[model samples]
Target: MASTAITTLSGGLVSVQASLQSRSKTLGLNLSCSKSVSAIRGLKVASNVQIDSSFLGKASNSSLWASVVSKPEEKQVFSSQLQPQASFKVAVLGAAGGIGQPLGLLIKMSPLVSALHLYDIANVKGVAADLSHCNTPSQVLDFTGPSELANCLKGADVVVIPAGVPRKPGMTRDDLFNINAGIVKTLVEAVADNCPDAFIHIISNPVNSTIPIAAELLKQKGVYNPKKLFGVTTLDVVRANTFIAQKKELKLIDVDVPVIGGHAGITILPLLSKTRPMVTFSNEEVKELTVRIQNAGTEVVEAKAGAGSATLSMAYAAARFVESSLRALDGDRDVYECSFVQSELTELPFFASRVKLGQKGIEAFVSADLEGLSEYESKALEALKPELKASIEKGVAFVHKTAATAAST
Candidate 1:
């Protein structure tokens, strides 16, 4: 027989109790509800619920609840264990843009986020208002225009910049540089001035160029921390993993391919020889997969016939990276992801590789992944260096030219 009771407590609180009697053993649960009965439609169980020891004693022999009942003195309640103690404030720049809107929605659903700030040049308030109705834990705030940018970034723990023009049919990422470069430079300057210590994820394209532009801008502001600045090449990695999974018929969750170098055409290198679970590939298979991965962005753009770029997948990848970063910030011990950052892994000043993330930022780079490359991968790696180097130098030059022009004026 089972019995349940509901009692109203002081201060608009409600108490729910349930007891079950089976085989002469009684199991009881006491839940302290924070909401009133009227608000119980989507009520979450309070963390301070009490559990009778008889239930633990009866379930001690069951392997399913062993971990829950093993530690009685530690007071490891299930609800409390699931609650995140350390939540962070994340700010999304260009929240009204194609990538920013979906990215903001995904991030708003994270249990680890306490505040979500959405900033854009226009139409951001409506976006924020829409996302606020999601019934998530994070409070959504909107900041419109340059004047409100600093407030959006203030006290933010992570700043994600996806605020730039999208790629159209027949437009190379470099074609976006002139417009997106200035956008990234302006947004990054606001980041440097407001949340200098925050982890900055640059998702603006030509990431190969915009990352360098961001680094230079931060350097000028005297707040550049190589570890905290990242060029989000997660999209490339996501595309690689997904493509490889489809080719091999492996589960998508079981596949992981490390993408390196820059974020543009040939600069995007998918290390097929280094895929996890150690699958063998024919030379033709390797070539086909590598080229497809590198050109995945163009495939999406062309598929849409200039409608838009890879906004949904880009948002997904960015959200995954953001979650990994938040986990690292929340003291998760073994958090690692592929990101483009200031690195000594290769001759290039900045490269994308697997790096271990931590409380402050990048704790260590998995530089060993670069060793013992396949012959084809080695040749391709060498082939990408010059073009990537040229892009890097171009970005550096843009910043310097801009500075010099301002000084001459």
Candidate 2:
């Protein structure tokens, strides 16, 4: 048997030697390893020693492996700690799109997700089949066409809609909204009919508008739950954290920036003055960072040369939001994330800011972050109101127009 010694700051040098054999009945893998690092915490072995079996698993079963795998039945007990049980069904709309496929794969890997339903109008079956082969605990199901959409949402605890058209270079928001708004309307209706109580995450572009579109459709269906609706603006926050960390030479993991306002253009606001661990930014630095964060989507789209939009990063951010939402539903009290939802934080009907998530959805909004905005941020906040309000009204108006047209027909 192989042995490895790991030196911890407090534990000095500790030697670990073990021959481990574990079986994951779901994936049907015989996991055997001669050496493993169980745990080292405060000179004592902590029960949760995450194992990396990426290279150890068979080629066919490799997709099933998690970066951190904890087996509780090992003969040499490292510790008694175990992660919380996995419990939640997450449905991903537009699972075949640029963002949706990767989003489905990420969600499929989550131990908290018990079932992942992938729904798209076309080519979703292959996406589902491919994701189903992963060794993760979640069961993957694909739903194709409008006929199967309701079935996909049925019994879901969380419904994430990234299912609209991606923004291409030179495409106006109205052009994007005209196409995506209809898609969102159709999908939100399905969610209302099948999973009215499921936490709805609207990731479709022009989110400032689509979110209102979703809200109105849900209201039409008599299933609108303000607390359960969320517009995933996590990408703005993710971009802000990354850019700020790089510019400030701060540890990325230690940095947190709250992005408020809407999810597009000038509407995305990164509250840099309020960044955790409190970093100072020159006025020029603040302006540059805010512009970059606001236009990060366009930056990616231009870089991709219209090949695609910000699919991967958007997928990652959506996954982060999904995980946070799941954690909140799992009763983890510390879960907080920035999301666009029905709000009174500003005069707008909807806004994006840091929110305390709970089992019942958004439990509270962190309004203090908006209290003391810097001069530039305050001015930017005021400047964005008109555009953000216009987007919200556009979405709300689209719903009413469609309804009126249908009634006339």
Candidate 3:
């Protein structure tokens, strides 16, 4: 009786094991191997099996695959290494200043950036050394003072100029023109001499003036590409998005307000009707939002209690512009941002509006839905023109006047 029972038990156990193996094969599962891995190879499988901790290493990780598979389109959730692409070099002039450090950090975070060159008149080595500790792939190098400016700019695909004095409390951007203008002229002259083909982004204060000054200098050097120069007006759009989202209780990511004209007080006009995910607004809401967007920089200045200006936000905006430029250089046609550029969208020589970015820089200027604008927006746009025109003339005049004096000398 004992012998018969033993034989029957062995036969049943063999049959059950065989059934499991056959079912696994039909389902395209191979448990016959005696190896461990961190992930399954080129497959997405879900299983509820409790893998032995010791079996979760070496040859295969299929034992660690969790839950039952239900979807065919599941992507790979593996621990395989990723291949890194070749890098682009980005140089930030004035990398030691309030804006430069943060902007450098952000640019360093870009996987596309292979090298970052930081330049300043003083204290840039420390900033470069500190940033170099980040485990990112971009190599950080510092070039100090005017003598090294060319070296810093050489081989750079994008050169960002934020090298100038910032606005103080109770001071208008115009008050910054004299000093910042000279600083911009000097730095841009170097950019023209060295990396003439690099995309130039001006972030210095009085950008309305500085950008024109830079453009004139580039033209003088005989390497000017109007499509390649940009005044960083992204901050205006960023503020508009934030302010609109606030009043409408909409997501910030979904808010889209086109801020055109120059980047100063009344010149920064935010057209709210063209807002994405469309929402209606009363006349009062329109007035309130527009005013708030125009003066958002001043809002930050006041909030800082005279300690400093909007360095953090400006850095963020500048970083965004640089990334867009890099993507454009990488041949992405979908990248677009509001930038103060040489445009025929208005009577002014330079205007800020949404522009498509491409490998050659400003791909095309985007026309805002002006015809559909609210009455308030239409009137506001007309009102902003005089101030915008004056600011544009001021920028152009500064460059021409300076050049005349230099030629006469």
Candidate 4:
């Protein structure tokens, strides 16, 4: 006979209810079958046996209360019941490139990822295959060549594009516009189709131009979420912290320098005055630090002596941004990181600043950094708007033209 029991383990109290088989047997048989309580420490088994021999067999069946430990599926169900639903699946487009490979590895290390998808025109199979060996729970999928771009993007929560040609010594982001612009546009089109709601992070440089290009393409697709798109400008902030600490004889880990404005030359504004735990600097020191931060990329380009431009450091910076986004996705209450995004913080169409990240992305823009710009910075900030605006317009125009042609065909 089957019996149900509710037992209090702490006090060793076991209460059981059983529907006993009422046979035409004598009253002595029923009295002798008084439920046996097996004093098992972990599981309490109270058995109501119908027959003499079968009573012991039923008492041994204590699997249900054997241990309160849960199976994987049961644990998952319990966890989901306790926590809110998870959101955000980060995608790395061009995950095979120099920056993308290392960046992809770092992102896979994050606990916030539910799924990671990799897209590239070549060699991505090897990249994905290598990353899949990692112990992290994130599942990596690779899409090779243009044909598979759509599949790579489908259901992505956050799409990061680091897919573009590296900058040569003499070339500006404008020089890269001819080629990288086309690459960014094609991939973003797939994103619009497959995962329109995903937060888009642009790491392909001329980020100053490519970010604008990304915005324009999304606008054309009619799925533009201004808060959802970002240019990964964490590299500038990384450089600022490194350089400021080195010069001032301060600890690098403690220094926090806020780099603002556009990502390129003359436009890249490092707010020296805003350095945390506030240190006062002389006029010459300020000028030197500003120049160093602005030309740090060029310094790397020159120092590599013709090998490459800032791949390792840039990868680290990009990876850090990926972590911040992941943390926000994991239902973190206050995840804020510096990024370049479409903003009205300044007159510029897009500005790089610290933004609070949430479920919907970009919860609040940190304009506190811009409140007390030096006179020199105020002038520089104003001057950057027109050039930045023009660059944005150029990108918007290019996508409109390309999209128009595709529609016609």
Q: Which candidate is the best by TM-score?
A: 2
Q: How accurate is candidate 4 locally (lDDT)?
A: 0.70
Better of 1 and 3 by TM-score: 1
What is the C-alpha local distance difference test score of candidate 3?
0.72
TM-score ranking of the models = 2, 1, 3, 4
Q: For each candidate, what TM-score against the reference?
A: 0.81, 0.83, 0.79, 0.76
Sort the predicted structures by lDDT, highest score first. 2, 1, 3, 4
| Tens digit per residue, CA lDDT, model 3, 165-229 | 87775667667888898899899889899999999999997877777788888998999999999
What TM-score, to 2 decimals, does candidate 3 have? 0.79
Residue-wise lDDT of candidate 1 within 1-409, one digit each (tens)? 1112212222222222211112111111222221222222122334333333333333211001111122334433232222335779999999999999999987876667889999999999899999998755689999999999999999999999999998665667567888899999899999999999999999998888888999999999999999999999888888887898899997655567888998889998999988975899999999999999998887988898878889999998888788778767876666778898999989899888989889999999987778889999999999999999999989999999999999999
Clashes of each: 0, 1, 6, 0
Q: How high is the CA lDDT of each candidate model?
A: 0.77, 0.78, 0.72, 0.70
Between the candidate structures 2 and 4, which one is better when assessed by TM-score?
A: 2
Each candidate: RMSD: 10.0, 9.0, 14.4, 17.9
Candidate 4 displacement at residue 333 in angstroms = 2.3
Show the lowest summed lDDT stretch of 10 residues, model 3: 15-24
